[model samples]
Target: MIIMWKNDITKEIEKKRLKIRKDEDLFETVEEVFDTRTLMALYRIINKGIISEMRGVVKSGKESRVYWAKDKNDNDIAVKIYLTSSMEFRKSIFQYIQGDPRFKVVKDYRKMIYTWAQKEYKNLQIAYEVNVSVPKPIYVYENILVMEFIGENGVPAPLLKDLSVINIELFNQIIDAIKKLYNKAKIIHADLSEYNIMVRNNKIYIIDFGQAVTIEHPMSYEFLLRDIKNIVRFFRKNGIDVPDDEVIIKWIKEV
Candidate 1:
């Protein structure tokens, strides 16, 4: 019975695989990312009607790639797929997972990558629930995460680091986001920085929460301080008058 069940599941996955292959352009783009397992995971997501069509790559890095996609309703969404074969990514994220109480350290590389994707999804959900300015998480399956797109058409919002003109208001808004993320959501964005922050229409949206840890983590305070320092350093470099990192950390911890 178990063997029969396994075969049935395989047949279903193969059916989805064929459906995905019908879109040659999307199949070609997906081929650039990884192997059959990743494709199968994406197929499962498509089978659920969460994604209608996969579009062009918006961002690519050693760890993951973000692709613009459309949902069944024809609305844009972001699909983030973590690279299962990136040893560098595995090494870099190990520290974040080590001290995080919510996730246990896994020995299998592929499973670790999946956990990393789930971590980001959960973190985004927690932040979004608290009204923190973050992308709304839609679904997570294996190494793939689907979320609300933060831009129009196929163009993404400019990162804070890429912007030429940043004002004090932006800095203050970011600080407020950090405080809310800390005090309300109880999640510390361990990898917070200008590069992961998106600015659109004078509003700031924090991105990339895979490395964020809850306040109960052993190194949460250390990570929190580092996040404060990164924001302060960036705003100060842009000629915005900002309080010292220490002072800002104190203020965030209050309440």
Candidate 2:
């Protein structure tokens, strides 16, 4: 004979969690509609102490959901959890990972997103190596990526596009930072735009490196030029008269 205590009935309580399903704001609505398996994956991560507490769901992107979590030391960490769905990612991922040596083995859509997250982890590693102020990647398991939370207390830094840094000082620093990124990293952040860069303490911190690509890749120059174009466009939008081609050339030959 065996008896189960109140705490022993935790699984039964968690069974009610089946009601959880796809977040409408997320890129994909749940395919299975309240899949116990996906929930189990989330449970496994939580149980492993990777994140001691997960707060409110933050912004949802085209492929992942951003969550604010607290670690063992009570420090905040940003968790980018990729949705299990893949229809959207299948279309655009090829451009970023086409020449990635680590991704040659990945063939399926689901595998591709996981590979994308892995790529992001590697990109962060490269950036940090060169002293770029992106988030410090902690752990990336499957679709989940845990990184240093870019915030203090409860406020995250506002993105560059959201704030104004008036003066040549801020602009020049941004240009210099891009120079380091291009020269040292030998990679271009393909999707970089004003919205993905953060301005904190009058310095720039680039984020969202998922689309960063190698310099030798066929699309590398295309991506590099596009990045320079976007940066120039942003600054020009803010009333700065600058030449996109000149900025690209300056970074290439003058840096």
Best by lDDT: 1
The collision pairs in model 2 are none
Worst 10 residues of 1 by lDDT: 19-28
RMSD after CA superposition, every candidate: 6.1, 4.9
lDDT of 1 by residue, 175-232 (tens): 8999999999999988889999999888899999999999999998888998888998
Weakest ten-residue segment in model 2 by summed lDDT: 22-31
How many residue pairs clash in model 1?
0
In model 2, where do residues sit more than 4 Å from their true spots?
A: 1-38, 241-244, 253-255
TM-score (all chains, Cα) for each model: 0.91, 0.80
Q: How accurate is candidate 1 locally (lDDT)?
A: 0.91
Cα lDDT, all candidates: 0.91, 0.72
Model 1 TM-score relative to the real fold: 0.91
Q: Compared with the true structure, what per-residue lDDT tens digits does model 2 show for residues 100-157?
A: 6556746777677778888898888888888877888888877778888886654677
* Inter-residue clash pairs, candidate 1: none
